[model samples]
Target: MKNIYELVTMFHDVHPFVPSLSQFAECVVAYIGVFVIKSVFKHLVCLECLESLYSYLTDIRNYSLIARKSNDGLLFPAKDVI
Candidate 1:
């Protein structure tokens, strides 16, 4: 019983520091986890955006190919449809 009391007292003496350190560790871990998730999501979204952009550009190129040159000296590609 005496040993248990001393152990409890010792733990009580360090109570403030224990919780503070635990909270700090948790925040650090959570920040890192959030950063990792954000990076992965950004990468995934960028890939999809790139594919859409390529498709749009290809469509414009096809339009330019079919458009006839006007009587004026300079005939520019048709305006972007989308």
Candidate 2:
């Protein structure tokens, strides 16, 4: 009943289309809490580890031209997303 760009923004309705969406949100929040708590509990862990993970898919992100030129090794197409 919705267009391709239209989205169900509510937490409850997502399950009709993808059954695990609600649970997936819960898991993400839980992981974010752990990431925050671990940063506070320890010495903020390794900043580089988080930074590198921020670009964890550096070579895999499609928006990067460098990814397109250099990422034939990655599984997804680097350019021509459409």
Candidate 3:
């Protein structure tokens, strides 16, 4: 929390408008996470398609895991259209 505050203060001049302090921390953390993800994706030309495929496969695996937890059909759906 303190680190977020320090970062926001340190980088305040970068943005034209300031968000309210209540939303500042959440916004900054989300912005940073997105920035990092974008930076990672930038290195690979076909990353977006691969990432989507990976995410869909993970969802299917998760569904199978859930189904195996019990005999009952808990029917977790796959992300078919990513």
Candidates, ranked, lDDT: 3, 2, 1
Residue lDDT tens for model 3, 1-82: 5788888887885767855554445434433433444555567678555365223232433343443453652222324321
| Candidate 1 structure lDDT | 0.39
lDDT of 1 by residue, 1-82 (tens): 4698898988888847434445445434433433444444556666654343222222333333222232332222212212
Best by lDDT: 3
Estimated TM-score per prediction? 0.26, 0.25, 0.26
On TM-score, the stronger of 2 and 3 is 3
Q: Positional deviation of 6 in candidate 2, in angstroms?
A: 37
Q: RMSD of model 2, in Å? A: 15.0
Candidates' lDDT values, in order?
0.39, 0.40, 0.44
Error of 2 at 41 (Å): 0.9
Residue pairs in clash, model 3: none
Candidate 2 off by > 4 Å = 1-21, 43-82
